[model samples]
Target: MKKIRKKAFEPIDKEEKELMESIERDEWRPVKNIDQEKKKAMAAARNTLRKDKRINLRLTQKDYHQIQIKAIEEGIPYQTLISSIVHKYLNGSLTPRS
Candidate 1:
């Protein structure tokens, strides 16, 4: 009759198991620089206070080209000219006479 040998069972080590458990329970916190956060918040607040207004108007391509040409001739920006025109109209400097 042949004798059968039993295999030895090894238990898990306590220190290694606790280390893994600690790693699993670790919480992740975002790393943020205080100065960067402050700058971002300030920029956001400024943008919120600075509103962009737009208007829709119809103009011929030739008229737009002419305005651009005139602005270039006067060494001024087209949008600056438009803003000045609008301001003048609002302040009664430019009046329409019929």
Candidate 2:
């Protein structure tokens, strides 16, 4: 005899399965009538400007001044330089020298 059981939460549910089937059948449609060419261009522009998220930063006056000097030398904004350094460090591209 086969065991019949029901778990509180199935790994997958019926609605999810139905949605997957619909997607596989290409029956899914966008809720909004977005223009392909125009929306695609706008999407690309939005992605390029995805740095829209902002955060508060705290720095000592001396460090801030030093960073400003470096930014001036690099011909970029201080905030941009700081963001780049943070990004590199987080991605493991920047390392502390021994």
Candidate 3:
């Protein structure tokens, strides 16, 4: 006989509840090539996060102050904010509000 158990916290949504129920029923199985999959995922994560190059940038005083203010509002460093903006623009996800 198998013992049933309840989780400390409830699932937050219908999809989450279904996933939790399936997991509790032992419906999921481990991947066969787990080590290889782990290595590939790690490599992809490293490539995504890599920031190995640097460049000297010039900005007007007003632009610099505005960037700093925006970064502070977003709770990130100004350099990170600039990097994110550039990345989003290159990926075609950033657009002017107007």
Candidate 4:
């Protein structure tokens, strides 16, 4: 069998090398200003507050299965159905049909 020769790998060109060096240097810079960091922290805190204010509720297995079946029939997730129900109730648009 004849021996196969491998080609030598070539180094990157000058412009490519300089571009890589610039990227490496810029990577060490601070990602955001102090004011931007503060604003981000405040936004995160507000989100946490909003999430924490929610109440946790429990449902019987039979009720949950019924809701899941209705959600499947409606082509929506059970959580979406719960959210719609809550929204309608809060908005005073939920009414029992005669």
Candidate 5:
């Protein structure tokens, strides 16, 4: 058993004070079945991933090098950059001015 100290006055912000008051009043409680809820969320995410399709494409050396450099600057794999560009173009959101 741990012994807690009671203070006459302690300065805390509104959110912290509210949280402490709720804890002191036993207003907070744990979920009855947390594992089941987490499993459901994981299953939903897996289902979304499973719907994705894979594709392969051949590119010229110049185009591939440019794509690789651009992908490096964007901090993503070249394949992922290509996928994002294709997706954006298909959705009519990627507009090339030049």
Candidate 6:
């Protein structure tokens, strides 16, 4: 015997509604090799996080001190904080102060 499952509620937003409709239409496909796909994804993530290069950056005394203070407050190294700032700015996720 087959059991029928009921949807609890309607999608709340356009993206959610579209996703639900797509699922109903069977537009999504399952990955063929789950293990292989998982390995590839893990490798890609490791490569993304690998920091393989170093460069010299000269900062003024005041600016460097402030960055160190912020890093300490965040409980991360100042270099990591600087790297994060650069990454966020490059990805358009960091906004400039008006």
Candidate models: Cα lDDT each: 0.77, 0.85, 0.96, 0.79, 0.88, 0.97
lDDT of 4: 0.79
The clash count for each model shown is 0, 0, 0, 0, 0, 0
Model 2 stretches with alpha carbons more than 4 Å out: 1-49
TM-score of 4: 0.42
TM-score of every candidate: 0.42, 0.50, 0.63, 0.42, 0.47, 0.73
Candidate 1's C-alpha lDDT? 0.77
| Backbone clashes, candidate 2 | 0
lDDT of 5 by residue, 1-98 (tens): 99987966774798888888888899988878999989998999999567378777989999999999999999999988998898788888998788
* Steric clash pairs (candidate 2): none
Give the clashing pairs for model 5.
none
Q: Candidate 4: worst 10 consecutive residues by lDDT? A: 48-57
lDDT of 1 at 4: 83
Residue ranges of candidate 3 with Cα displaced over 4 Å: 1-32, 96-98
Error of 6 at 97 (Å): 3.1
Decreasing lDDT order of the candidates: 6, 3, 5, 2, 4, 1
Stretches off by above 4 angstroms in model 6 are 1-25
Q: What RMSD does each model have against the real structure?
A: 24.3, 12.4, 4.5, 15.2, 9.3, 4.2
Whose lDDT is greatest here?
6
Alpha-carbon shift of residue 43 in model 5 (angstroms): 7.8
Q: State the lDDT of candidate 6 residue by residue for 1-98, as single tens digits.
A: 89897888989999999999899899999999999999999999999999998989999999999999999999999999999999999999998998
